[model samples]
Target: MNRPAPVELCHKNMRFLITHNPTDSTLNSFIEVLKRYGVTTVVRVCDSTYDKAPLEKDGITVVDWPFDDGAPPPNKLVDDWLTLLKKKFQEDPGCCVAVHCVAGLGRAPVLVALALIESGMKYEDAIQLIRQKRRGAINSKQLTYLEKYRSKQRLRFKDPHTHKNKCCIM
Candidate 1:
């Protein structure tokens, strides 16, 4: 029997869900839901209009990531993002992680895809998850990155080694 494609989880499980365009109402709603589910970490890209008080009101930790402007985040920035997610994962191994940007099609999906990639998800699977969860579009740079990302992986599905560049270490 053939297994069906994994449905991208935008709901829970320390899973990374991308919400491309989150209005104030939507953001508040999501925060409330996450609070109910006990999700602690919420990484957001820079926004002058964003108010952190809502998250604080709900006791969720919000990390401001200014590198999500539809550009391929720098390697150092990506490293920092991974480090933050790692720390969050370690702090509460039972909580869900959701990363979001303006439209979820650019920085959010790319970083989340990288997270899935690091979490042992195959390239196509990771990208598919992002597309399914976020939107069908991941921008040009992200798509290019994914194609190259999958190509670098060993066909055997072994873990990737520490990368040396911003693109992909596979």
Candidate 2:
């Protein structure tokens, strides 16, 4: 079977691989493709649940943040997603995060765009970037959300030795 490959969106130290959900038959191939991109985490935003055991067995972390189809994620979920990205990058600079929501067009791309915006790219630029790479990405509602999104303050991290807090800007 010919499986569609994931689209990669990389900006500086942040990298995201967005694709459709894998089925029982495609899971192995999906994992291979993810490995090629050095993906360390998989974020599933769709309502459908899959067996994460295979992905986890390959040493990839799986995060579930499900929401209704065709709707923007809750603010708290967005915040948490960003936080996870920040921490993941801090721990492994070269690792990539794989995101998917059924078709890899809507929610997955929205989250990636938000991350790009937080990483200092303008919202328009972010949307354009994702659409360029992963055709038919954000929908009208998601695009509106991206247009109005104001990035939250950068998460603070403490220096282990100095015991001082510092903002780790993406």
- Candidate closest to the true structure, highest TM-score: 2
- Candidate 2 residues 53-123, lDDT tens each? 99999998889998877788898999899899889987876479999989888988898888888877888
The lDDT values for all models are: 0.62, 0.84
Q: In model 1, where do residues sit more than 4 Å from their true spots?
A: 1-14, 21-27, 149-170
Give per-residue CA lDDT, model 1, range 70-96, as digits (tens). 677777777777777666655655457
Deviation in angstroms for 93 in model 1?
Answer: 2.0
Relative to the true structure, candidate 2 reaches a TM of: 0.86
Q: Give the lDDT of residue 118 in candidate 1.
A: 66
Q: How many collisions per candidate?
A: 3, 0
Quick one: best lDDT, which candidate?
A: 2
Which residue segments of model 2 deviate by more than 4 Å? Answer: 1-4, 153-170
Which 10 residues in a row give candidate 1 its minimum summed lDDT?
150-159
Q: How high a TM-score does candidate 1 get? A: 0.70
TM-score of each: 0.70, 0.86
